[model samples]
Target: MRSAPFLGLSVAATLSGCAVPEARLRAGLIDAGLPQPIAACMADRMVDRLSLAQLMRIADLPKATASESVPQFLRRVRALGDLEILGVATSSAAACA
Candidate 1:
């Protein structure tokens, strides 16, 4: 039996959506302890390959949403205010999901 070489490509393409540019953000979010599910949603949301600058932009975003006792970095993320952090969270979710 023969299989389509690209059969696996669809998933690769789907994840390729933003796999590279979003690497840093993903790492950061993982470190931040953001729940896995929400993080996956954000990473899957990104479609285009980002420039290093754009990746930095995503990396620059915050992680922690609210509730002080959570963590300092999370609070910093909330204070800074950047939705891209969701990408980070999303990536983590992808890992566990």
Candidate 2:
């Protein structure tokens, strides 16, 4: 229906204002215990691939006090129970490493 298409456009417009910056995403990743280089690589890839809502969601995940290993980070993400987020993070970690 015409209403469905219009609703989609409206939602897109609203989310456009919520776009997460690459630098912020990278910083968040680093805060989450990833190394700087890996965080930067993953942030670039994820910002391109994930939606705004997903990005915002991940931003609120637990941050580590110290740098964490890849396996440790993945395990923490997996614990949160969002498969798509986990998948993107895992693949990005693999690709960036």
Candidate 3:
């Protein structure tokens, strides 16, 4: 019985640690030059679907060039119709425009 409780606590702790804060994600998006509405929508949509690992990858994306804006990067990704991985849809892109 003690082991079961400890296991449950471990799982809860792991899951809590993996959660990406919505505000942080939103701020990251905005800092990357995405308009506020788009940033807000993307953060809200992604927080539920993306793992902490995925969010970290996005946050670490290289901003080496001015042309390589977040919206541009996302547009390229969306062009491949892979928004499901990002937890968004093409319709969400429309809202950003």
Candidate 4:
């Protein structure tokens, strides 16, 4: 006896946390020592729903293990390789923007 709409809403809420808001993502980057402007760049790209790998690359995140959580992924992105451009992803993700 679960309603379909309720299930849908539940899914959306769960996914929203995984997706996160652009502002929060930016703040995380700055707190992690990444430049603040990159947040805007990443948010601009996010206008399109990017793949998980694409987001990781744009944010300069590392590959995660089975034990990793969504926040863990964000943390890795914040590390950001100490570079503004993150060195073009070195074959990770696609060239497509």
Who wins the lDDT comparison?
2
The digit string of per-residue lDDT tens for model 3 on 47-77 reads 6676665555555544434434455857644
What does candidate 1's lDDT look like per residue over 33-61, in tens digits?
55444444444444244345544654655
Q: Output the better candidate (2/3) by TM-score.
A: 2
Each candidate's clash count: 4, 0, 0, 0
| Pairs with backbone N, CA or C atoms under 3 Å apart (clashes), candidate 4 | none
Q: Order of candidates by TM-score, top first? A: 2, 3, 1, 4
Better of 2 and 3 by lDDT: 2
Which scores higher on lDDT, 1 or 3? 3
Q: Highest TM-score: give the candidate number.
A: 2
Q: Comparing 1 and 2 by lDDT, which wins? A: 2
Q: What does candidate 4 score in Cα RMSD to the true structure?
A: 10.9
Candidate 3 segments whose C-alpha is farther than 4 A from its true place = 1-20, 62-71, 75-97
TM-score of 3: 0.51
- Model 2, residue pairs in steric clash: none
Looking at candidate 4, the ten consecutive residues that score lowest on lDDT are 88-97
Which residue ranges in model 1 land beyond 4 Å of their true spot? 1-17, 46-54, 57-75, 81-97
Instruction: Please report, as a residue range, the 10-residue window in candidate 1 with the lowest summed lDDT.
Output: 66-75
Question: Using lDDT as the measure, what is the rank order of every candidate, best first?
Answer: 2, 3, 1, 4
Candidate 4 residue 34 Cα shift, in angstroms, is: 7.7
lDDT of 2 at 18: 42
Q: What is the per-residue lDDT of model 4 for residues 7-96, given as tens digits with 9 covering 90 to 100?
A: 999999977766555545445444544444544454545524544455445444432334433344344644655343333322111232
